[model samples]
Target: MSEIKKSVFDAMPQDLSDEFFELIAGNDEVKIERIISRGHTSPETGWYDQAQHEWVIVLQGEGEITFADGRIIKLGVGEHINIPAHCKHKVSWTKPDEETVWLAVFYS
Candidate 1:
C-alpha cells in the first residue's frame, strides 16, 4: 500500500483576516481539526458552549482563552487545555506577529 503523508503546518494562507480551520480526520464519536489563528478572538458577546468535549494544544505561537466565569488561561507552544462539554469559553487573544497553530480534538 502507498503511504499518505501530511503536515499540520502546510497550506497556510497569507491573508489571515479570518481564522482558518481544517478537518484532519473524524469519525462518529470524535473529530480532529487544525486551526490557525493570527490575532483572532471570538465576538465580545459570543461564547463557545460546545456539546462535545474539546482538547486543544498550541503547536506554534501563543493564545489566551477566557471563560464565562472570568477565568483566563494562557497557552504557548507545547501547551494544552481540556474544555469540558458545555463549558462556556471564548478566545481572548492570540499572537499577532505570527501564526498560532492549534490542534483540536472534539469528542462525545
Candidate 2:
C-alpha cells in the first residue's frame, strides 16, 4: 500500500481575523485537530466544557488559557496542557502579531 503523508503547517489560512480549525484525523473515541489562532479568544461569557478529555500543544507562537477556578496557563512553542473532561476553560489570549498554531487531541 502507498503511504499518506501530510504536514501540519501546510495550507495555513491567511485571513487571521478569525481562528481556524481543521480536523486532521479522528475515530469514534478520539479526534485530532489543527487550530490556528491569531489574537483570537473565546467569548467573554463563554467557556468550553467538553465531555471528552483534551490535550493540546502549541506548535508555534503562544497562548494563554484561563480556567474557571481562576488559574491561567501559558503555552509557548512545544508546550502542552491536558484538560480533563468537564473542566471549564477558555482561551484568554494568543499572539497577536503572528499565528499561534496548536495541535489538539480529544479523547475519552
Candidate 3:
C-alpha cells in the first residue's frame, strides 16, 4: 500500500469550512471523533440534558461553559474538561471578537 502523508491541518476536508469534524474511529464498544471548531456557538443560547458523555478541550480562543446548576467553567487555549452524560450545559459566553476552536470527543 502507498503511504498517506499529510498534516491534519492540511488534510482537513476543503468542503467542510467553518468547522472540521473527522470521525477517526467507532465501534460497539467505543467511538472517537476528532474535531476542530472555530467560532461555533449560539450567542445567548444554552443547552440542556446531553445524551452522551463528552470530553471537550480548547484548541484556541476563550470561552465559558455553564451548567444548569449554576456551575461555570472557563476555557482558554490548551485547556480541557470532561462532562458527564445528561449534564445540562451550554456555551454561556465567548469572546465576541475572537474565534473559539474546540476539540470534542464523545462516548457512551
Per-residue C-alpha lDDT of model 2 across residues 40-62, encoded as one tens digit per residue = 99999979999999999999999
lDDT tens per residue, model 3, 4-70: 6744345545443455567655666456665554455444555756667888887667878888789
Shift in Å, residue 30, candidate 2: 0.3
Q: Model 3, residue 5: displacement in angstroms?
A: 5.4
Would you list the clashing residue pairs of candidate 1? none
Best by lDDT: 2
Q: Count the backbone clashes (under 3 Å) in each candidate.
A: 0, 0, 0
User: What are the TM-scores, per candidate, against the unseen true structure?
Assistant: 0.95, 0.96, 0.66
Could you give the candidate ranking by TM-score, starting with the highest?
Answer: 2, 1, 3
- lDDT order of candidates, top first: 2, 1, 3
Better of 2 and 3 by TM-score: 2
Best by TM-score: 2
What would the TM-score be for candidate 2 when compared with the true structure?
Answer: 0.96
Q: Quantify all predictions' global Cα lDDT against the true fold.
A: 0.95, 0.96, 0.69
